[model samples]
Target chain A: MNQTSQPKLWLAQQANRFAPALFFIGLVLLWELICRVGKVPNYILPSPSAIITAFFNVEFSRWMIHLWATLRVALMGFVLSIMIAIPLSIGMMRSQLMNRILYPALIVIQSTPVVAVAPLIIVLLGTDDPSRVLITCLITFFPLVVSTTTGMLETPPEMIELSQSLRAPRYRETWQIRIPYAIPHIFSGLRVSITLAIIGAVVAEFVAAEEGLGYFIQFSTSFFKIPQAFAGLIFLSVISLLLFKSVQWIQAWFFPWSLPKKK
Target chain B: MDQAKNSAYVSMKGVGHQYAPQAPLVVKDIDLDIHRHEFVAVVGPSGCGKSTLLRMVSGLLIPSQGEVSVFNRPVTEPRDDVGIVFQKANLLPWLTVRKNVLFPLKHKYGSYSAADEKRANELLEMAGLTQFADKMPDELSGGMQQRVGIIRALLLNPDILLMDEPFSALDALTREQIGFDLLKIWREHPKTVLFITHSISEAVLLSDRILVMSKRPGTVLDLIEVDLPRPRSSKTINSPRFAELTDLIRGYIYEPDVPA
Candidate 1:
């Protein structure tokens, strides 16, 4: 605020911005040092440099095949869950009977761990894209439904009264007032779901898949190629990070007002 | 007084509402009449059911006993002729100022026409909010948002405007400014206004008559005619008679009705 305070404030902000990156780099250096000093073999734990070498060892076309396999299943499953979750949320909101019937069923499904059921799903639906997508959908579904419903129900009572006073149809209340109010909550759900979608794809590949980063990791570790598996894990994390950032970017591009801090 | 009661445009006779089936009433034995195009302000302490009274007239809530009628017909359901302004601006945050003003029409009819758009722009101009028409509700000051609220209420050309402590959310200076702004707008386009407030001076400053209500089981304690001259300004607030009327209403509020 004051002229004397400006430089100190700027320095504080700079420190805050670079603190995490510096910490991460320092951690990687420490790990690399420990491995070298201890004369640790590459199989037990791959050093950062070895992991980077392993990443380069894989053929470019092979990496793309695995990346596409994981991305396709994750995206399809993510899109499918959104289609089902949003409508189901609206239905539960609009109808007391539907809420009563579907609520307990949804709870039952959500509580059942997808990992526990993955083998059975692959057995029943076969080890194809369909079973894999279903697994991803199950992982991504609950947060979307819960957040969307909570947001719609949380519309201000006075706004609902305003709708009623206008004698507007009940559907308009849902479409105009309730849905827009729910956007921020829904986007938060999307951010969580996008990451979960990637996790879901990996989990599916762990059970039954020929190609994906998850499958690559499993295949590498089995062959005791620990550095290659580490490489696959790192790649998976990078993709998840990109997907999360893309969700945030979509919200900023389309519904800037829905972002709470933007205002 | 009898003739005025008989000719009242909106009247309540023995209106009462119970909290539960056999429980004590929230508001009881309320009898009042509002003439057409007159601004009536109701002031009462907290828990006096001032908002409940407004809701009953809006036909959003029903009275368990007696009746509320507007234009000589019973108010059994929310009417198209009445508009309500809530305590908060209650603007849909996603909509622009222009869209919010036209929300009632779009909400009721599913869409707005070119003519409705013209009316919205004109009203925004009148409220001196034309420049901010394209802006979101959160960008405006509290007072400016509430002015847009009043504009939204007036968009439908409703005959009765029920305002439930509309300026209560604003700071004192902004409240006074918006009160005068409301008066200016009311002069240009008059409607039967039932303004509710916690501020005694605000009631005195804005209304033709002030309805002082009792605490719990809220009944009308006094309906004092303002007797203040029209085109009221800070000069009117400075007048002695204004003090007397506010004092009269204050006396009714403070005089212990139930023995301790």
Candidate 2:
């Protein structure tokens, strides 16, 4: 009896996993039908089919160029933010003087609007990729710092005592115990910042850049190529989704223990 | 007297500690000597600084007033001679059981040799955790985790092992089982052990001598020696002497307001 039920249970679980995708497809079909039956103007509200056609009509090479430009800025900004934020957070956690001097300043900076500051940064650094990357980095930096520091502080008191009893050196304790314990929190920060990195890059492009998906959206809308503008928006969402999924995959790979075990 | 004085593995001289300079002393005027290759248990009421006394012996905390020494050396900092286990198993969640056992050894000695690996495997075998050695801490039961904690403390071959309520978290059956395993292990490889627990029965079962403490501003009330035969088992607790010693310790813990 158990053997017969096992495969049946497996089949149900697989279907349960795919139920969300099936509902998404049904929603898209309903949207397409509504657009066709209403005879809506393509410029006002393009159907999903029209958007797909617009996406394909653009030469793949040209589409990739814009996508690559946006991706490069976002990726560079994200990496740079991690590089700066982790060390700064670690320093702040380790020394009271550093924390007192920089922590409040960081909170004040974080509270200010990134869009308001982007133009000022562009004026200071030119309308080049450097300014765009800097804007993205600014937007992504705070969450990483906050999450990393919180994780470091949350290292269990018993673990600290254990390390002390072992007479572990300061650097070794930080590297081996505190940092690994903080990894799940750090990844949570990464998940939040990756999405913001994309938004930051786009906002930067809107303010100053001559290239990227953000520039494509601005140029398309100006010419009333509404379907093309929708296509660029779609590409942005696709890129964000892919990056989010990649972070989740890397988290699962590096910290398998954090994942829930299968029965 | 000279031989006993010379063999004192851990000596505490009027040790006292408080969190702040003006705060009431947590445990005061603690003078004790744990002899070499002896199992010593400390039992007391809750918040009686039983853990504080254990911490002082491990050199995790410097006493506010007096000194703690191990093997004739004054302990100003944590040393390689001491191993400590906290109330929780406190195993690193990221490491497998075998790796967690070898963690301190790797940190203290820089790296592990073939001999270290063999010793780790032998410990796992001895604990009957051989099959689960590669598993993570979360995969094991509470009893198993504490067993691993014990093994991790043992790996460095420290002269003194200090345990703070190590078995209090386990269910009664598992606690008894692990307590038996601990006694057997101690019989085979005897080291000076200072165990702290709230359970008077556990103190009676494990230690050569039980130090019962009074309520807060904790100080040793009585040091009762257990005259039970070596290699004690579950049947030993049913013996008349075990009951008398436990009752005697319990009286010190509960009847602190009344004069002796």
- Best prediction by DockQ: 1
Q: Candidate 2 local accuracy as lDDT?
A: 0.90
True-vs-predicted CA distance for residue A96, candidate 1, Å: 1.1
Docking class of 1: high
Q: lDDT at B128 for candidate 2?
A: 92
> Candidate 2 residues B66-141, lDDT tens each?
9999888888888787888778799999999999999997665567988998999999999999999999999999
What would the per-residue lDDT of candidate 2 be over residues A99-200, giving only the tens digit for each residue?
999988998999999999999999999999999999999999999999999998999988889888988787777877888888889999999999999999
- Residue-wise C-alpha lDDT for candidate 1, range B133-236, written one tens digit per residue: 99999999999999999999999999999999999999999999999999998888988999999889999999999888998989988898988999989889
Model 2 stretches astray by more than 4 angstroms: A1-15, A260-263, B1-7, B255-260
- For candidate 1, the per-residue lDDT at B255 reads 48
Candidate 2 scores an fnat of 0.79
Question: How well is each residue in A42-135 modelled by candidate 1, as lDDT tens digits?
Answer: 9998899999999999999999999999999999999999999999999999999999999999999999999999999999999999999999
